[model samples]
Target: MFKINNLSAGIGGKTILKEISLDIKPGQVHAIMGPNGSGKSTMAGVISGNDNYEVTAGELLFDGKDIKDLDPEERACMGVFLAFQYPVSIAGVNNMVFLQASINSIRKYKGLPPLDAFDLIELIKSKMKLINMNPDLLQRGLNDGFSGGEKKRNEILQMLCLEPKLVILDETDSGLDIDAMKAVADGVNAIRDDQRSFIVVTHYQRLLDYIKPDVVHILKDGEIVMSGDYKLALKLEKEGYGWLS
Candidate 1:
């Protein structure tokens, strides 16, 4: 569903990712593992169309169309969802309000009728249950005063609600306890279907223990140094990146 061909991107005229290429097929989960400053998150950012970075060479294609020129919102509307590494707090925006607006915006982009209040409420309730989220969270400001686990679960809830074709989760396991990680992983696994694809970027193999990626890629210095199945993650856990270096 998504393909990156020799994509080199950077911010402020400094290259961060150099000739990175990847192919994510439908219903497959791909895990990207790397040490800090290895361009893991930079790959995610560039794919989601973060304007801070500029692509100096190569292409990013989604569903057979080149998306280099598309804005972030446009990429989102086209079924690309990037769950942030650090979810920012919106102090005044109600969670349900934000979700409704986001969903409706995507719907409108696809020429579909907007969901009414009743339908939206039902949808939110159903998706919230998937992640075991508290209903009270919907009434609170987005990510405001939420615990770390709560914030991560909230991100999973948004992913479930949005139903993006390609889900890019950047460190969704960071700061999460084992139970919280399992819950978040369960939510991700629940949403997996024949038409959906996922790119999971994480540092540790613990997250892979729960999510079980079909493909594991070791990214270092802005490029993928190695790619394999789930066993690669386990190897990294035991041997570390030094073995590959």
Candidate 2:
């Protein structure tokens, strides 16, 4: 469903992702593990259409189309949902308002009727239950007073409502407790289908214990140094990434 061919990107003339190539197939969960400053986040940003980094070389194709020049919203409209590592808090914007607008926008782009406020409210409640989130969260300002786990669950709630084809989770497990992590993983696992895909970018092997990615990739210095199955995560945990050099 997604392909990155010899992709290279940089910020302010400094390249961060160097000739990285990857293919994410439908219904497959892929995990990318790397140390600090290894450009994993950069890869997510580039795929999400972040304008801060210029594509120095290569092509990014989504669903068999060249989307290298598409804006973030454009990519999102095409069924790409990115659960950010650090979700931004927007004051004065009700959480439900943001969720409804996002869902309506995608529906509009897909030629579906825009959901009215009533339907949106119903949808919000249903998805909140799906992610085991509190309905009270919908009444608050978007991410304003949410704890780390709340913010993460909020991201998952959005994913459930939109039902995107390709989900990019950028360090979604960063700050969760074990139970919270399991909740998040369970939510993700439930949504797995033949038409959907996941790209999980994380630092620890704990999240993998729940998600069980089809492939595990070790990214080093902006490049993929090794690729293996689930056991690779165990290796990285026991031996560390030092041997990846």
Candidate 3:
């Protein structure tokens, strides 16, 4: 469902990704493991059409259409979701309003009618249960005054509601306690379907223990150095990224 072909992206004038190519089929889970500054997060940013990075070369195809020049909102509308490494706090926007608007935008893009208030409420409630999110948080401002774990849970809640075709999570497990981590994993797994896929970017293998990846790619410097099965994550956990390099 997602294909990156010879993709190289950078910020300012410095290139971070070097001829990076990978394919994630529908229903497959791929984990990207890399040390800091290895361009793992950059890949996520580029794929999601983050304007901060300029693509020096290559093309990205989402569902067979080139998306290299698509904006971030456009990508999200095309069933692409990025669970950010650091969840941002929108001080004034209420979480419920933000999510409902997001859903409406996506539906409009797909030529579908917007959800009614009752339908949206029911949808949010169902997704909240799936993600183990407190319904009370929905009434609050987006991420304002939320705890670290709460921010992460909120990200997962957004993911569940969006139901993206390809979900790219950048450090979703960072700053999450064991219980919170499990909740995120469960939410992700619940969304797994024949038309959905995941690309989880993480430093530690602990999160992979809960969300088992079909393939693991070890990224280094600015490229993927090695690709292996789930066992590779275990090896890296024991030996560290230094050995892989």
Task: List model 3 lDDT by residue over 44-142, tens digit each.
Answer: 999998899999999899999999998899999998999999889999999999999999999999999999999999998998887678888999899
Q: Which tens-of-lDDT digit does each residue in 114-145 have in candidate 1?
A: 99999999998998887778899999999999
Q: Looking at model 1, report the run of 10 residues with the lowest lDDT sum.
A: 124-133
Q: Roughly what TM-score does model 3 have, to 2 decimal places? A: 0.98
For candidate 1, list the clashing residue pairs, or say none.
Answer: none
Model 2: per-residue lDDT, tens digit, 1-245?
89999999989999999999999999999999999999999999999999998999999889999888999998999989999999999999999889888998999999999998888888788777767888899989999999999999999998888999999999999989998898889789879998899999999999999998999999889999899999999999999888877
The ten-residue window of minimal lDDT in model 3 covers 236-245
lDDT of each: 0.92, 0.92, 0.92
* C-alpha-based local distance difference test score of model 2: 0.92
Clashes of 3: 0
Q: Which stretches of candidate 3 lie over 4 Å from their true place?
A: none
Q: What is the lDDT of residue 29 in candidate 2?
A: 93
Shift of residue 177 alpha carbon in model 3, Å: 0.4
